[model samples]
Target: MQKFSFNRRLVIIIVCLIVSFALMTVSVAVRNKRSTPPLIQQFGNDIVGLTDRIVALPANGLSGSVSSISELLNTYQENQQLKKQVGELAQTKVRDQTLAKENKQLKQQIKLNDSLTDYSAISAAVITRTPSSWQNQVVINKGSSAGVVKNMPVMSGSGLVGRVAEVNKTNSKVELITDNNDSANRFAVQITTKSGKTVNGVLSGFNANSGQITMNNITTKAKISKGDKVVTSGLGGVTPKGLYVGQVAKASGDDYGLSTKLYITPATDLSDLNIVTVAVTKQ
Candidate 1:
């Protein structure tokens, strides 16, 4: 009986709270219904007056319109920037295509020249050259895979350049005629004698600054002079005949044990060998 009484009292309290809340809501609504219509009517009239004044051009909405104008100006600026970028991209693409075409044409020329060459020369590009010193040597873009071997004769259109000394994968080294190696094993060349009649001395490498050749073991009785031509004799099976070495730049020093000293210059410009052809077959 006591539990039933406690439950009934708790239910009564909840019912009372709900009834009070509903009465408060009804009182607020009745007050608003009586006072709100006049306020609404007055606000509508004031909005109409302001809009008419603005349309007549006697009032300014500067502050209200500035944000909209700023947004429009930003949009215009963005569109202009986009147009400029498109133009620049188009111009750059055209320039890139032109450069690519020109580069292809130049490579074709190099390939054609290589094809017509006498020696069995593979195509290669010179990546770099030495500095200061007479770049009597250059590194080519060929190696053992390309049939490049040691002591292969290398040449250009003007004349013989040098021989291959070192070969590696995708690269090879060309030692020019004026290098230290060629000087040691000097060739007593009989040149295409345009310089002079008394030009029958072997040419060897000399100090570059001296700008001369050391022709040793010259027969003392031979009539040798300055500005004479020196060329290969096709003798040692090293260099073939008719390849011009250098003009007899000058003759210097007294007679050695059994040879006279004849100084000479090389025919091919060793310092400036750009493109060269290498004969794979060692002659």
Candidate 2:
């Protein structure tokens, strides 16, 4: 009887296994014939997509805001730079206009192709000036080939500017009267007082701060006053006589009252020289 019971239990176990296999096959076939996934799986996918959009919305907006702010800052900087350039361009234009007007007036005042008493003038343009000695020297387009020689007096549209310091085949260097060096040449200048008295002095140095030349060695008793016209005395054989030098601005006695010192405002605007004349004494 125990042996029969054992065989019956084994058969029951084999029937249960067959029933589980048949159910698994039927479930697989039903899933494959459906057009869409089960409802629970579809709901889970929708939840995942919604969560992704909700998380990315603020992040994308923040990225766009940052890009706009960066572009605005760059544009502001570029606009400021452009404004500065425009301002500079405007200033340059005004300066150029002023220079052109001055140049035209200077040319008219010079009276080209004219002679000054015993000397004939040669017109020349200022070619260059070195920064190292800008107040003391300038280079002219005229040279030895154009009858320019050392110690020859140079004049501007208004009056005397300098003298030829060095001469080359094509160009020459002019030593301005503003030079204050120890070895600088002096001009023998005379002033015509209001009463027609002539007061003589030596133009020795330049006061750079005042933009005036200093004249010394005048007699303390000379009757010199402001606005008196000064001219070359021709005492120095190199520079010709009767060249207009400047006007006396001030006159004062030196220390100990031994001699008089006169400050002269130059006849020409020596600072800005464009066209100049080389006075070549007629042979």
Candidate 3:
């Protein structure tokens, strides 16, 4: 029974092959005789074309999707690179601006040193500053070895900022004018009015809220006005004469009404101290 079944399959295959060859021969003969294909051949061609289109649909769609995904990934990578570059550029710009500002301040200090012909200038970089005592004091890299001594006036940027409070071998602590301590040193400041009258007073305290220095004990009611320039009076032989202190922001009657207390705005930013100059007056 198995042998008969195998023989039947072989016969069916042979018959199909013979029929296919006969059809190919007839198709070629028909094509030579007529411009149009035979109806049977046309039907077979239609079937093959339809099958090819149906098979290619998913393949074409998958190819398009793959291409789109590749393009999307590339674009995302480019965007990330661009963002990194932008961030780096922004950081560089900020650094450059900071450097430029520091350079300008250094130049101004150089000019200040040149103008102080009577006193020798000791330039020092601010080495230490605590947030709690930022306005109160700062430590400089210069010390007693470099002619930095206690009570020497320390100037930053353009004007007087502080005085040497403590001196060490390699460093010194400077007490700023904004120090509110009761034992803080007071500056003998004088303001020259528009009428050429010099009114002298002691810079006693600082108003932290208003960021202004307070001057009390006005010797005479000299009609102090805004924009009046204040300078060191050379009194007590501590701070030198002609050193710029600040400008008068406002003036009001003192507690006893016998004198006026002036609120003076500093010429430079007291909070942002960098390189400072210590005026070595005695030496």
Candidate 4:
């Protein structure tokens, strides 16, 4: 009985499919002949139209999704391109600024060379500074090959900075005037008074806290006053004449009260040095 029921259902399904196919065929034939379709054929045409409308909804949605994905990909590519352009622009700006700074330094060096007509100028760039407790030493890119020698005076834009302490073939070291080592740091300086009388003293020490250099060992009767222009006396041959040192900021007696001491503010900004000129006397 169960097998008989299954067979009956299968036959019913096959008969329904055959009837639907026949109705579609007749509908096509009638439409081609330009005749009105019968009732069954018209029903088949209506069913096909409804099925096409249902299928077209998902097809249209798929096409819209593909278009949105393509647009997103284009947007991502454009963003990446813009980022690359910005990076290139930043690099260009840095290069331009560096060139401008170097040009300004060169022009200043030319002016300094013209003013100091007495000494031959050998321009050198500062390579490094001393990292030890003695911060008064610097290395320059000039050496004996460029005629830089030991005890040669080094000057920046404002005034004297230091003296060449050691010279190699391609580099040299400068001992700044503020060096604590007494034997290598003394300078014979003269202060020009308002009355045209010159009072000479030795620059032997520096006060780091006060930012002043000490010109000590002066005679008790020396008439040194504040605001006097101090310059190299040219007594020793290490530094030449007329090189500006500083002005006398103050004057007082020594710690022992035996001699007078003049405090001077250095003309040059010793904390910052970029380029310097080595004064090499003409042979």
In order, the Cα lDDT scores of the candidates are 0.59, 0.75, 0.78, 0.75
| Rank by lDDT (best first) | 3, 4, 2, 1
What 10-residue stretch in candidate 2 is worst by lDDT? 29-38
Clash count, one per candidate: 6, 0, 0, 0
TM for every model, in the order presented, reads: 0.46, 0.57, 0.57, 0.57
Candidate 2 lDDT by residue in tens digits, 1-283: 9999999999999999999999767645543454333455445534543454455446656766988898887897899889989999999999989986776677679964323335778898765565785347876766666887677788897677787766655566688998775545677777889987887778888888899988877874658889998888766666667788888899888767888888999999988876899877654
The sequence of per-residue lDDT tens digits that candidate 3 reaches over residues 32-127 is 454335455545544544455455556656866988898887897899889989999999999989996776688797874422224668998775
Residue ranges of candidate 2 with Cα displaced over 4 Å: 1-117, 133-135
What 10-residue stretch in candidate 4 is worst by lDDT? Answer: 30-39
| Model 3 stretches with alpha carbons more than 4 Å out | 1-117, 131-135
**Every model: Cα RMSD to truth:** 38.7, 39.1, 38.5, 39.1
Candidate 4 stretches greater than 4 Å from native: 1-117
In candidate 1, stretches whose alpha carbon ends up further than 4 angstroms from where it belongs are: 1-124, 130-136, 181-185, 191-202, 253-258, 279-283
lDDT of 4 by residue, 1-283 (tens): 9999999999999999999999877755553453234455445544543454466447656766988798897897888999999999899999989986776688697864422224678998776677887658887777676888777788898688888876665667788887876446577778878888878777887888887888888884657788888888766766677788888899899899988888999998888787899988644
lDDT of 1 at 188: 46
> Clashing residue pairs in candidate 2, if any?
none
> Judged by lDDT relative to the true structure, which candidate is superior, 1 or 3?
3
Clashing pairs in 3: none
Q: Which structure among the candidates has the greatest lDDT?
A: 3
| lDDT over C-alpha atoms for residue 106 of model 3 | 84
